[model samples]
Target: MMSVAPSELESPETRLAPDTPWVCLVWNDPINLMSYVTYVFMQYFGYSREKAESLMWDVHTKGRAVVNTGGREQMERDATAMHEYGLWATVQKDD
Candidate 1:
């Protein structure tokens, strides 16, 4: 059998493309209230009340929600902001 090179074993992101859009995700936590999460989304992201509530519900029931999507740097910034608001957050390339 042929052997593969180290360079060939790239992550999905690297193999797909470098400019793939990234997303900031907020995870559910026991401490933060659902209303507070909804409020944060409305205030920080300027989402409509209904939209904010929907995302908050997603976090509550689904365990996580995509709070923002854009470039990697922007997604990182969004994740940091969520952290500042005391929400669990992380960034990853969009599938």
Candidate 2:
């Protein structure tokens, strides 16, 4: 194994600033039920029933919702978890 220096790594020009925010977007898809989506939101995020339901509604009506936000790594984890739960999700840098 070889050790690589951080300075040798290439960061893309579009890379986010050090503290730039990221978000996990949950998209409405035909497969998952609305009740299941809301339950996932509550289970994964620890959101209250009302909050989870509200976000679920936004996803259903808007076709998507910003389910969570934080550092890039956190958003990535959240998106992955959503996928594991059979939900459509993506992580993106907040604009």
Candidate 3:
């Protein structure tokens, strides 16, 4: 039997790495219309009409879409903005 000391388990691998990219995800909701979601993407992200439509469709069928990616603070801000726009949104670390 091998026994490990407690100190051996607390390695640098457990620390939170800096500059890790995060993502803002928009989830599908029953209240918001597809047109409104598309419009929000276009208006908020400045995406092209076709691009916004495509992302909106992705969210509709897939249940969620990665709308933005950056630092955790930026993702949080983006999720807040989506909330203000009446969309279901959340910030998460990118895998």
Candidate 4:
């Protein structure tokens, strides 16, 4: 019988590097108004009304919006911030 080391069990390329970028996606929801979505974007991301509204519109018309992109940790924080603001959000690798 042979045993494989833990590191050997995983593919090297599958590991997430420390500096990889991630995106925070805000998804449209029936309960949240468009204006409220814009407000959340501005309040949490410091985006101007124009930018916030643009992202909100994307979420409305496209079904989702990538509100922000940054390092994995930052994107996670942005997702958490959006959650705190009572909006639907998630983070994923920027691919």
Give the runs in model 3 whose Cα sits over 4 Å from its true position. 1-18
lDDT of 4 at 70: 92
TM-score of each: 0.81, 0.81, 0.80, 0.78
User: Model 2, range 1-95, lDDT digits (tens) per residue?
Assistant: 89888666546543553568899999999889989999999999999999999999999999999999899999999999999999999999899
What does candidate 4's lDDT look like per residue over 1-95, in tens digits? Answer: 89999888676666753457789999988899999998888887899999999999999999999999898888888888888888889999987
lDDT of 1 by residue, 1-95 (tens): 89898777787778787778999999999999999999999999999999999999999999999999999999998999999999999999899
Candidate 1's C-alpha runs over 4 A off are 1-18
Estimate candidate 1's alpha-carbon lDDT, on a 0 to 1 scale: 0.94
lDDT of 1 at 3: 89
Clashes in model 3: which pairs? none
User: How many clashes (backbone N, Cα, C below 3 Å) per candidate?
Assistant: 0, 0, 0, 0
